[model samples]
Target: MDWTGWIERWGEPGVLAVAGLLVGLGFGFFAQRSRFCLRGAVIEFWHGRFADKLAVWLLAFSSAVVLVQALVVAGGLDVSTARQLSARGSLSGALVGGLIFGVGMVLTRGCASRLLVLSAQGNLRALLSGLVFAVVAQAALGGVLAPLREAISGWWVVEGGPSRSLLALFGVGPWDGLAFGALWLVVAVFFAHHSGWGFWKWAGGIGTGVMVALAWFATYQVMSHSFEPVQIQGLTFSGPSAEWLMRVLSEPGKPWTFGLGLMPGVFLGSMLGAALGREFKVETFGPGYSLPRYVTGAVLMGFGSMLAGGCAVGAGMTGGAIFAVTAWLTLGGMWLGGGLADRLIDGRHA
Candidate 1:
């Protein structure tokens, strides 16, 4: 409750970075342990199977929604100033970008966060893809691809505030959101049971979701306590990837921030998780894998994430937990795109 000591010890940026690190660590550890991945869920759904992957994804998503909504309803958290709600957004960008990202994930066989986790677990393929993803994301953010991203994003704009808040647009109260989350939680639990998930699987999924809520809460707390302004945010990979990339390449002395800490935290946490699970092993691309395919997917994901304003965990679970309009639209587009991609690409191969 008392942030004074922390502020005095580490200052605003340090404290914020530490918060991000803690949240990222939790997310990475749990996600790695649970094998939480939207791509797997998407693949399962497209294949017409309700299985453990879907159950894990649902558990993570619903847990985030339930906790976040409960905090808001209880006056324990105020998300009004969060960038997902207060910043201007683009519906066209969300739709198009999400679709591209979904396709890219299928091609790469992993989403942005999943790639990071896999990389830490010593997957050379994922390491290469993640590096490409970061480069592309950086290019999209302010480099060569910025112009194209801006052009697409400018197609349909929505002002900040209520316009971006799905809860406001739908005339739903926080209590209603809480109830909806609870319903989904029940569904997730049912599926988990049906799939015969062990304790670690289910618990890890829930922990991954809890980290999202904690990210929001932690950032909010930092913003509320600091004299310097801070952006309230949750678990997101796109912006952080870009930020980390820039920090490494150009800004050695860049001020410490939440995103700066989050990237490394995830890597360290995932490494720890892999080590603990005895899953850490150096893996390179096999003869069956194509370097060109991963390169192409990484390029698409990089550009798409920038245009969409987030990646899967970013816009999907994090933004969806708070009922952001663009986030939901982005999520819908991802499902549509993932299904189509799976059917067209993987299906043919199968």
Candidate 2:
């Protein structure tokens, strides 16, 4: 298919909006059905239970890599368009930011993306959490915390040479990237089978990964072909949350971008899924848990995600799939941060 030509011919604002909705619906359905969540998956892995969730996550990551590679080879998409996929800084920020994000999620009981999905399912606490996260993220991106983030990011420089994809770093040609990606996929599948997760769960996990890749393809195609072409981006949660807020406040004057539209579409699609499944449940801050905890978690997540430059969906699954070094850093940081929180909570309980 001549994707470029097709998009040029018919990729109007309305068509792009429809494409965004489709992407959102696909993601919501897959996430809801598979219960795919990075923080939750990491926590389960830490506890040595629900190992299946981790497998699912890895499978999704691997799937995205494969799909992205195919798109690149076919000349339909370029991985570099997505900010997270760029060969950027080293492990410091991603690791630290991810750790903070992970710990915050534990304290709050869900990651940023999970909070969005849960909120759609009627979790008022998550709604509150999402709001706090949006505010803090905006603040960090351009508010009080902006200076700190900029200073830290500026300090770190990619050593040895300019940023390059993992495949390039290893001295492999274009095809090598695909081969390496497939290796990860094979490993994920093998681990899943050995971990005692049923075949159905494993399949669900793989399906979730494919869905993520599809989201990238959908967005890339829609945006590239739109009347106003934008840099290619993919499934991320943090920045978009804040952007959505800004757009809502600054309506037609702001002129809705694909990123802005996609964020809300995901939320709406998830809500529809919950309503259809009869799984929506309204929840709020329970007794004894002060508002401070909720606020703190949100703030930490917002700042952490901003510094890290993406959330779990952005860095861990989406960026990781594309072999971005920053994504790995974020994943490491998120896990460490979560582990730290777990330790602190455990000590307090003890």
lDDT per model, in order? 0.91, 0.72
Model 1 earns a TM-score of 0.98
Backbone clash pairs for candidate 1 read none
**Compared with the true structure, what per-residue lDDT tens digits does model 2 show for residues 1-350?**
45566566655454455555666666666666556677667766677664767777777777777777777677776666566645456456677778788878877877887888888888888889999999888888998999988777766646323263555566654466677778888987886777676654565566656656766776777666556755566777887789877766664565445556566677886777687668888877789556788778888899889888888787777777776777777878888787668768644332
Residue 164 lDDT, candidate 2, scale 0-100 = 33
Provide TM-scores for the models: 0.98, 0.87
> How many Å off is the CA of 239 in candidate 2?
1.5
| TM-score of candidate 2 to 2 decimals | 0.87
Please report, as a residue range, the 10-residue window in candidate 1 with the lowest summed lDDT.
Answer: 341-350
Report the C-alpha lDDT of model 1 over 1-350, residue by residue, as the tens digit: 77867988899899889988888898899999999999999998878788888999999999999999999999888988888899999999999999999999988989999999999999999999999999999999999999999999999999999999988988888999999999999999999998895876799999999999999998888888888877888889999998888887784777888888888889988998999999999989889789999999899899988999899999999999999999999999888888888888878535
Q: Positional deviation of 30 in candidate 2, in angstroms?
A: 1.0
